[model samples]
Target chain A: MTITKKEVVHVADLARLDLEGEAIDRFAGQIDTVLAYVDVLKGADTQGVSPTSHVISLFNAFREDEVGTHLEREAALANAPDKDDENFVVPRIVG
Target chain B: MKLHQLTLYEAHERLKKKDISSLELTEAVLDRIDALDGEIGAFITVDRASALAAARAADDRIASGSPAMAGLTGIPIAVKDLICTKGVRTTCASKILENFVPPYDAAVIEKMKAQDAVIVGKTNMDEFAMGSSTEYSAFKPVRNPWDLSRIPGGSSGGSAAAVAADMCIAALGSDTGGSIRQPASHCGVVGLKPTYGRVSRYGLVAFASSLDQIGPIAKDVRDCALLMNAIAGHDPRDSTSAPRETPDYTAALKDDLSGLRVGIPREYTEQEGLHSDVSKAVAAAVATIEALGAEAVTVSLPHTRYVVAAYYVIAPSEASSNLARYDGVRYGFRNASGTDLLAMYRNTRSEGFGPEVQRRIIIGAYCLSAGYYEAYYGKASQVRTRIREDFETALEACDVILSPVAPTPAFPIGEKVDDPLTMYLSDIFTLSANLAGIPGMSVPCGFSQEGLPIGLQIMGRHFDEKTLLRVAYGFQNATDFHTSKPKR
Candidate 1:
């Protein structure tokens, strides 16, 4: 399954990566090589066994209800790349 | 002593004995990082003033003869960038999180502080633990101490690189698939991915919530065991945290390999795609175990092959959903502005995520979307069930399973950069553990032709991490592959 340049473009569009020129070429080349190696899946004998979700055999590892202190608004919003009063500021989304 | 050179155990012992103050240990590591970090790019935030303050408190605790705090007081340890450290910036190695200083400590960091472990600094990682190599890190790729040009293995690459480079004695790393184990092997150190739910995930920026787990990376099995003691156990803050009594990991480690029933999944070894060096390393590691009085037997994990495919589908699907919360208004990176809510989401995520991450998010959205859900996401879940059954049955026959951690050692930086598929394939050997949510460890086994480290993975049943540690530590004592270090 050769990942075509088109697929890279599609994936890029889907992933929202802003790319042009060299990055496009680089991602396409890199993704193709990776797909080539993972092609080993084509030869595996997956006959009757179930595909596993977790290796450990525990079920329902839920915790008990507990209350805890959360960070104050000041601390939580301190690291935002862009922020306003007690909230993150961003580009206007709609007309 | 070079600060980065001391193992966690060594540093702790010295601090406990009062031979060296925590401040001295902290200073030494800070100095070492100051001198060599320019070349390796491991630390994201060294926190000198805070680290010294923390060290001073640790020394006070030690001098006061406080039993609990003495355990980790004065030992400098690094945190993966993903783990939130209150007031310290928690960058997932992406511009989206460039300035995201978490308001609180991640659960594990809190545990570390409680035990008196001095904070060395924050190490770099793949933006949001997505990349297989540290190359995807927005800041810089952490070089393998063994070779500055090669990657240390990623997402957790900086964490492992820090340990190997002596940037810190031990570091915390999260493994969604193989992040911790793979890099540990690449850099010739110990990496462990505890069984899912073994360590609390609260405050760990979610990559794939179901598969993600936090674990320890250190110079040897003992260090990992000790660190696990501190971090493992039930935490109410994390709903998925295991409630069972955590075992004494250190107590499980001993020279006695007697009665250890080791299973070698024929499918893992027979896979046509295994690299020759990795195959050889797995085989040799088995032989050494046999010599230690452990019985090795061939077993079948029929669905082992689908682990990677299933993982890509499941992890991304979960990641796509988990990351949806990062849309600008609530938290995380934000773009300049948008006309409305929807536009804000589009613009913010467009600017926040890197290429690979965005790619996964799209694929995840598509697979989990309304029309395609049954075909892709639905089918993947069914496959996930089969994979879990395969391990369950295999474990019934044996206490532990052995395989290669990664298909190969650390590859050249740009070798697979162009091929996302090739990069994904590198995780062939490690993906299963995450998919199955079991405990997996990477133990340095041998070297590649290029003298790069190759790691052997030993997996254990869910919640039965004792066997994994027992077997891994047993292997460590039988060989000296772990003692070798890279010349910086």
Candidate 2:
């Protein structure tokens, strides 16, 4: 499970992160070391074991489908870096 | 003495008795922060005007009627920056969110406000709560109060140091792995990580959803309990919050350990690189508990060795997904130089995130990627089951498990910053409790030869924080370690 530079670039693409030059080399080296350590799980005895995704078993947690207090448009957009009057403005989505 | 030095319970009693005004207490704490925070680097932001204004309002209520005074009325509490504060800047100690003020308070912050607590400020933390040491904070490294050159264990280092230095009475900190407990141990304070879902996570900037829990860092065990009383409960905003009845956590603070069964996990002590001082202190603390009439027995958590691996895989996988929301569109920093939407995402993320955050994201995406998901994230989840079962089996024979919070006490600030794997291993003894969804706490046990503090960790079954608090309270009542202050 050695992490290669091309693999780093591929994963970075999927994650929408740009790692170029020395960062790519550094991340490849560091992630490779980490992956090697995590590979120890391959030897574990997990036969017929269901993965415990959530520690405490939770049932369907729901509330009545009624109108609830919600954040205002201004409040919701408080932290937005680029916001138009009513919506978050991102880079052009379509050419 | 400065009012900041008073414990939460003591301040509450005095506030109720009308001996000290909330404004006076708030001023004392603010003055202390003004004097000490520059050297300690504990607080990222201190909202003085708002704190004093809140304190005055608390005083008005206290003067109005007997029942008007809540337990935390006028008490200045520091909050970790990761927890959102309405109108107050909530930086997860990352440059990307440095000026990002939230429009709403976190659930825990709402709870504190309901009790009339004055939030002194937001404290520093490792960016996105990723690192074991606060060195990963983009702003500055939080220095340990005990020794300024050393680190305050993180990612709750700033909160721990503020409490240790008496800048605030008690602070709220989140523990994903060992964020709260490890730093509390290093700073010689009480830190508690309640059972997963014990505290609501609404507006807590998500790190690892399954593992994240917000708890109290206090001057002693009793204050931790008092703070817990104010903050722990169910919240509809956070779906994972357990729908269990909230108990008076302070009622569990009986100074006795008789008839309690304490289990010592052999795997913890036998682990290599466990500092001799930390091991000896834990062993001695167990002996003290045994003398207090609790029976001690050996219990095995055989899956202990695999915890670090499992945690690294699971936490980051979740983090990678959780952090996707911060893509520079709806919130925080944005680099708008890209020509297209996809390029915008890449360039924004590249410029906004720090090195450790980038590293974890890359690692997480790799683990959850289609081809590798089964071998990594899937297998890691099954190993998680084994770890949980190990705790369940051990708890069947014991009331609580006693262990060291971390392998070693706080190291020098820059010691492990370069080696990510070694830093990850520092959380070896702590990650299992999170994986098992149990409550764990740290109380000051002993001091290393260099005068750094060591923490004794007590872990109990899910929803059984009472037992953990009782045992820690019993131990603190018999020791003076928690009262020792670091010289400025």
Instruction: Indicate which candidate wins on lDDT.
Output: 2
Cα lDDT for residue A19, candidate 2: 78
Per-candidate fnat, comma-separated: 0.46, 0.86
lDDT digits (tens) for residues B1-488 of candidate 1: 55457777777777767888888888888887897889998888889999989888888888887655545667888999999898888889988788787778888888888877888899998889998888888777788889888988988998899888787878899999899999898989999999899899998999998899999999999999988998998887787887779988889898889898999998877776677987888799999999999999888988776777777778878988888777666566776565666656667777787777776776676567667665556667667777777888999899999998888778888887645666876787788788778789999999988899999899988888888889988999999999888876
**Candidate 2 residue lDDT tens string, B87-144:** 9999999978877989889999988887779999999999999998899999998999
lDDT of all predictions: 0.81, 0.92
Q: What is the TM-score of chain B alone in each candidate?
A: 0.97, 0.99
- List TM-score per model, in order: 0.91, 0.99
Task: Highest DockQ: give the candidate number.
Answer: 2
Q: B120 in model 1: Cα distance from truth in Å?
A: 1.1
User: In model 1, what is the error at residue B125, expressed in angstroms?
Assistant: 1.4
| Candidate 1 residue B163 C-alpha distance from true site, Å | 0.7
Model 2 chain A lDDT-worst window of ten:
A18-27
